[model samples]
Target: MAGGGRLLRKAFPEHWSFLLGEIALYSLVLLILTGVWLTFFFAPEMSEVVYQGRYVPLRGIRMSRAFDSTLHISFDVRGGLLVRQMHHWAALVFVAAIGVHMLRIFFTGAFRRPRELNWVIGVTLLVIAMSEGFAGYSLPDDLLSGTGLRIAQGIMLSLPVVGTYVSMFVFGAQFPGEDIVPRLYAMHILLLPGLLIALVTVHLMLVFQLKHTQWRGPGRSNRNVVGKPLFPQFMASSTGLSFMVFGVTALLGGLAQINPVWVYGPYRPDEVSTGSQPDWYVGFLEGALRLVPPWETNVAGHTLMWNVLLPAVVLPGLLFTVLYVYPFAEQRLTGEWGGEQHLCDRPRDRPVRTGLGVAGTVFYAVLLLAGGNDIMAYSFRISLNALTWIFRIALVVAPVVAFLITRWLCRALAEAEQKRLTRGQESGEVRQTVEGGYASDHRPVTRFRPGAPRRPIGPGEHTGTASQEPSAPTRRRR
Candidate 1:
């Protein structure tokens, strides 16, 4: 059994590219362990209860059991606050690692052929992770989370026909309702988690079956992997990372307090904070909302849900869908089919693919910045409408420019490579030759033909049949 375990461990790849997925897996494990601990004390119910927790400052306040329990965990339960904070922090890390990992795959052109479906699955996992975080954050029914939900509902209601139905189904009624909290709780704990787990399982299976992409270098074929095994090295590194995550969570819990529902108070209809924001993962959606023009109209007695909802829901859905289908779309465009690629350190090695990835990243960043439009406007003292228009135009124009620039850059590099192959490398300095001509003291150029006569030539010398003497004469002399 020990020998069998050793063999299995030896089969696992230990490349750094493989670590991105491991980081995500470790974060998920931390989330689950912390979540299980918190579940014992948390009350998912939204029924109003008088707050009488261990915190003397906010004693006897009127709040829901969820809020009161949160208070207890924050102040009373042994290391409860730290555990809670760790879970939240780990969640953030999990989402971030997955995003970066997907970017790495995209830039490396690893999302080709056999791994296209895995790419789709990865995008789905991201969507589910975002949903889970949103739901979990909102379960306390705090002012901040409530405001976010309201924005979300508006986005949902912006769809042309089924907006109202979707909104109603999601919220369990309009605005502040009793069922919303419990519904979010169920999704946060059960639905999203299940889906995420299943998708992750499938993703891992695909990864093992297809194998990880190793770095591209001399003698490194795409099928040949290079790295440590999963047993001692990878396992040790992952364990350390898990501990690091826990430590960071604890530090954040002790030093910085986020989502202090006690401070925000209960969810009231009239109250609004100046900078109420959703979690970082969903910030891009918020940015889109700020950038969209507030236009409204009525068609056939049904209100056009454009002003409030379109940016929030439809746009984000479309964006994620595009990400999911991008690999297949790219394959169709390029007509290049392959299995997993060997990893490459230089982004320019695969120019078009890398450029496309960069363009997509820039597009996402633009939207994310747009999400913070109000903050940007306030800081810069610019008209919000003007800011919105600028971003809206950029939303269309920036991506096109990025795509063109990236493609141009790629073509330029390819041209440079061709030139290098034909003309040879240039030395930095020019030297005067003894034969009254300028010469470069650069390394001699080496030609790579499978099997051919090798004769050294000066610059500008003919290298084909003109340069070679008749071999038949030499054979006759021999």
Candidate 2:
């Protein structure tokens, strides 16, 4: 028991900041646990089957077993709905927590020097996470997910010569197929998850090696992380929080109806809703699609595709590449040698870096909003063309504005700090009388002591003799 306790103590080391990574880990665990349970009942095969389940409304429907099993899980299986929901919610939380944690690392400049590789690993994990979500969501073969897949296919097909071949390979046929679900199932359950676990393991290992970034304060450095040790308090808190997160996710799953396959019906290729949207994480890509003008040209009897390819493949790739490269890019821009700098209480302490981050965020946000152009236009009763144009304009302008605003705010903060340093901090307000164009109640400056040695003015200077004597005496004698 002592050995076990010692091991536990050495492992966790109580810290709240450590909990950020813990949240992600816990979420992933929940996802896997719930996913394993779901896999038992879920039919990965894409064979067509008639739905004759307890849900009276959707009985006698012809659909793929994958979809049918999903429906069964939704309406028939005991607590299946809750399990499914928990799985989904956990996935969302997992992705979201990782993103926030990465951002925390970024703004604090923790990704500098020795930790740069870990930053790359983190970005790769994010890509895998999103891919996992995409593949998992598509497993049910529902309308919404199918629509998303179509967009994905469109993106895939937008590639140059190999586009059609890639799409065919991915889908296993033209559009809906018997093999696609199984392939995606393989990816969702096996490939992506394996990659995720590996990446996460590396990420954690790197974190432990690098140590946690500390909060900015006097004498505090990256090496000195502030928090309770892992033994009893951190472990207990982490365990309790994990259970709490699991419970909340379960509760939401039970109460909230998400991705109702019945409502979406089956995947239909020809039909598409006016405002079909994917989950929030992938919304930025969709926004880019909405904003880009639909243009096409043919050269040498092959289509030169810009509209589909750019938003789907090129843009997303660029975004991910930029994210992965940002730490290095920043290092290059600053020209400052890297060192451990954990605490960053003020964003303005790194003004240029902060501005860049904000600008990138603004750019992402603009693209995200642009993804829902149809919804926005329909809701506002505006022309789709106008909406697209507006987004395109905002895509260019918003980042500039965000950069300027962030820079200005940083400068203002620096100015405030400078003022604080130059003028003594006011404890309480005191009225000052205007006399000799100076404040009457100001404190007087004290002169140097009589025996204090004066600074040497030049070579052969004396301390307190002729050279140090007041010049006013000589002037008066003359």
Q: Provide TM-scores for the models.
A: 0.84, 0.86
Off by over 4 Å in 1: 1-15, 54-60, 338-346, 414-431, 435-440, 444-478
**Every model's Cα RMSD, please?**
8.7, 11.6
Candidate achieving the largest lDDT: 2
- Model 1, 1-478: lDDT tens digits are 9866743554344445667877898788888888889999888877888777776666777777777788888788999888888788888989998999988888777777677889999998998898899889888777787788787777777787897898888878777677888788788778898898999999988877676665543223555554555667656777886787667767876787777767787666687655656778998887777776777889998888575667776777788888888888887887766544544434665667776777777778888888888888899999888888888888888877887788788778767665565576566789988899997755444432225554444332323332232211000000
Clashes of 1: 3
Output the number of the TM-score-best candidate. Answer: 2
Worst lDDT run of 10 residues, candidate 2, spans 469-478
* C-alpha lDDT (0 to 100) for residue 59 of candidate 2: 78
Write one digit per residue (lDDT tens) for candidate 2, span 1-478.
9856543444332335546777889999999999999999999877878788887776787778888999888888898888998898898899999988887777768788777889899888888999999999999987788888888888878888888999899888878767888999999999999999998888877766665565543223445543444556556777899998888888888888676778788676777754567878888988888777778999787896788778878888898898988878877877756555454435776777788889988998999888888888899999988888988999999899899999899988777755554453454546655553434233322223245543322211111234332221100000
Measured on C-alpha atoms, candidate 2 has an lDDT of 0.76
lDDT (CA) per prediction: 0.74, 0.76
